[model samples]
Target: MRQVIQLRTEQLGATARTTLSARSALAWALIELQRHEEAVAQLRGLLPLVLAAWGEHHEAANGVRLHLGTAHFASGRPARAEELTRVVLAVYPVMDGLRLRAWTLLASALSCLGRHREAADEYTALLNAASPVYGEDDRQLLWVRTDRLHQLAFLAEHDLVEQESRALLAGLADDDPLRAAISGAHAFVLNSAGHHAPAETIVRAALAHHDGADLCLGLARSLNGQGRHEEALRILTDARTRCRQSGDTEHVSLLHTLTARALLGLERLDDAETQARQAVEAARTHHGPTHHRSLEAATTLASVLAARGRHTDAREHLTHCAAAWRRQFGPHHPRTIATDAELAAVPKA
Candidate 1:
C-alpha cells in the first residue's frame, strides 16, 4: 500500500501542476487506513495545492480541511482538531451530514480538552439534531451516549449515568459484540451506586468474554467493594500484565493502586505500602503531580501508609495531597473535602 501510494504520488507530482484531487485521494486513503499522523503530514503538504486549485471556497478545498480536522483528532492533537473543526462547521452548511460529522469531531476534541460541560453540550446537540434525521435508536448514536455517560459519571450525576448506560445496553442484542462493554459500563454504575454484589456478577461475566481494560478494572473494584480482597489481587495481577503488553501505562498504574488497595484489605501492610508508593510515583511521573490520576494514586498510598501504622508518613502524604486537591478541585470540591477528612484523621506532631 505504501508503494502504491508513493507510485501514484510520483505520477501525479511529475506533472507541471499537481491536482489537489489526486493528492486528497492519497491523503484520504491514509486516513482510512488509520495512519493519522501520515495523513496530517500529507494534508499539510497538500495545503498550498488545495488552496491554489479550489481557491478556499470550492467544495474540494473544504473537504480537505474537514479531512485534516478528523486526522488531527485521530492523531490525539485535539487542540488542533478543535480549531480546524470549528472552521469547517462555521461554513459547512447546518443540518447536513458533513456538518454533523464536524460536530462529532468537535465534541471529541472538547472531551479530550477536559471541558466536560462543553463536551456534554456538544453531544446533546449532536444527538438532538441526529435523532430528527436518523431517529433515536440509530446505532450511530451509541458512541455519543457512551461518551455522555462518562461525562455524567465524572460529574457525580450517578442517576444519569445509570440511565444512559442502561439505555445503551438495551439497544444492543443479547449476544452483540458490544454487550460485554456495555455490561461492564453498567457494572461500573452499579458499583458506584453501592450494589457491589451485582456489580461483581456483571463484571465477572463480562470479563469471561470481553477482556477489556474497563471490565478488568471494574471486576477488581467490585471484588474490593465486596471485601473479596484476594480475588481482586489475583485479577489485578493479570490485568497489569495484559495492560502492560498493550502499552497502556495509565492502566498499569491503576492496577498498581488497585493492587495496593487489595493488599491493604488483606492486612499485607508492607506490600501494600510498596505497591501504593509505586503507583503514586508512576502516576506523578506520567500524569503530573497535580493531575487527577496522580491525586488518586497518592490517595491510595496515603491510605496504605496509615493502615500500615506509618502515621507520620501518612500525615505528610495526606497533607500534600490535600493541598493539591484544594488547588486543582477547590476547597468546596468533593475530592478536596474527602482529602481534608483523611488529613484530619492523622494525629498532629
Candidate 2:
C-alpha cells in the first residue's frame, strides 16, 4: 500500500493534482493502517491545496481538517487536534454526521489533554445532539456515555461514575460488545472507592467476554489493593506485553503504573522505581504532563522512592504532585486529598 501511494504520487503531473477527496481517502487509509506520520504529512500537504481550491469553510476543506485532527490526535498531539476540530465545528454549526465526528474528536482531544470537565461537557453536547437522530440506545451514544463516565472517574466523581455506569449497563445486552467497556468502567469506579473484592469480581466477569486492557487494568488494581502483588504483577506483565505489541501506548503507560505499584507492594523498591519512571515518561509523552495518569504515575514513583529511603526526593515529588492535583481537581477531590496525604507521610530528610 505504501508503494502504491508512492507510485500514485509520482504519477501526478505538476499541472495535475490528485482530487482532495481522493487524497483524503488515502490519508484516512494511512491512519487506519497506523502509519500516523505518513497520514499527518499527507493531510498537512493537502490542506493548503484544499483551501486554495475550495475555500476555508468548504465542506471538502473541513473534511480534510477533520481528518488532519484525527491524525494529530492519534499521533499524540491532542492540543493541535483539538484546535483543528474546533475550527471544523465552527464552520459547520448544524448537527450533521461530519459535525458529530468533529465533536467526538474534540472531546477525545480534550480528555487526553487532561481537560476532563470540558471533555465531559463536549460529550454531553454530543449526546444531546445525537440522541434525536440515533436514539438513546444507539451504540455510538452508549460509547459516548462510556467516555463521559471515564472522564467523571478521572475527576474523582466516583458516585456519578457508578450511577451512570449502572444505568448504562441496565440497557445493554449481555452479548453487546459495548458491555465489556461499560463493565470495565463500572469496575474502575468500584476499585476507586476501595471496594476491591467487588471490583475484582466485576472485572473478572468482563474479562470472560472481552480480554481488554481496561478490564485487565481494573483487575490488576483490585489485586494490588488486596496485597496480592504477585497476581497483579503477572496480569500487568501480560497486559503490558500485549499493549506494546499492539502499539497501545496509553494502555502501556497504565499497565506500567500498575505494575510499579504491584512491585512496590512486594517490596521490590528498585524494580518498582524503574517501572514507575518509565510509566511517568510514557504518560507524559502520550497523554501530556497534566493528565491524571501522569500524575498518578508520579505519585507511584514517589512512593517507591520513599520505600527506598529516599525521603527527600519523595517529599519533593509528592509536593509537586499534590499541588498539581489540587489545582486540577481541587483540594477535596480524592486525588488531591490522597496526594496531600502521601506528601504529609513522606519523612523529612
Candidate 3:
C-alpha cells in the first residue's frame, strides 16, 4: 500500500467500514493515477465491506461493483469485468449514470471476448437508452458512438462505418474541430476500402484544422497505407519530436511504432527493430502489455525481428500479440488475425 493509503487505513481502522469510505477513496486515487493493478487489489477488499455495510441491493454496493469492474477492465481482465458488469446491470435500479456506463463496459467486454455481433447489439441497446437521456452530441453518447464505429470498422462493415461517420459529421460545422476529428475518423473506412489517397487527403485536412496528436497519427497511418513511407516517416518523426518536447509520452510511443513500420517499408531493418523495441518498451511503461497499443507495437516489432532473421524474437512477440489481442480486441479482429498469421509463418526451432 502507498503511505497515504496505510495512514488512512490506520485512521479508519482495518476492521471497520465507515461512512468516509477511506478504502474506496484510495481505490479511486489509484485508478486516477493509472495504477490499475493496485486499484484492483484495493477494490477487491473494499467491495466486500461496502456490500456488508450497505447490503447487496444497496447503491453503494452497486457502485463498488461498477468501479471494481472498471478497474478489472483497465487491468486487462475483461472476463472478470464482464461478469461483474453483467451482475450489476441486472440489479442496479438507475438507468442513467452507473447503469449507462455499465452497459457501455459490457459491450466492450463482449467485444474483447470476440463476440462482436453480441457486442454490437449491446451497443445499440446502450445508444437507444442513452440517446433520450443525453442528446446525440453529449460527450458520453459520442464516446459510445465512437466505440460502435470502431467495432464496425473492425468487423469490416466499412460502408456502415462510413455512413455513421458521415452522420456524425453532418451534425457539426465544417470549421468545427469536431468535424475535423470526424473527418479524420473516416480515414479508417477509406483505408479499409482501398482509398488510401483520399484517406491521406482527409487526414491532412484534419491536421490543418487542429494540430492534434490523433490527427497527426491518422495522417501518418494513411500515408503509410499508400506506401508513401518516406512521407510517413517524416510526419511521424516531426510529431515524435513535438510529443517528446511536450512530454506527451503516449503519442511519443505511438509515433515510434509508426516510425518502425515506415522504417521496415524502407528496408531499414536494424533501425526498424531498434525503434520497434523502443516503442514496445514505451507502450508497456505507459499502457501495460495487454493494451492494444502495447500489443500492436510488439506485433510491428516482431515483423522487424523476422525481417532480420531473428525468428525466435519474432515468434515470441507474435505469441504475446496473439494472446493479448484475443483478450483485448477479439480473435476475429484484424489485428489478432494478422498476428496469428505471422506466427504461422515463423519457422519452428
- Candidate 1 per-residue C-alpha lDDT over 170-218 given as tens digits, one digit per residue, 9 for 90 to 100: 7566566567666766776677567889888887776666777778888
Q: What are the per-residue Cα lDDT tens digits for candidate 3 across 53-153?
A: 66677777787788888898877677888999999888886777888888988988776655666787889888888788888778777767877876676
Superior by TM-score: candidate 2 or candidate 3:
2
Which sequence of candidate numbers ranks them by lDDT, best first?
Answer: 2, 3, 1
Q: After superposition, how far is residue 173 of candidate 2 from its true place, in Å?
A: 2.6
1 or 2: which has the higher TM-score?
A: 2
Cα lDDT of candidate 3 equals 0.78
User: lDDT of all predictions, in order shown?
Assistant: 0.75, 0.85, 0.78
lDDT score, residue 87, model 3? 90
Which candidate should be chosen as best, given lDDT against the real structure? 2
Best by TM-score: 2
Clashing pairs in 1: none
> On a 0 to 1 TM-score scale, where does candidate 1 land against the true structure?
0.75
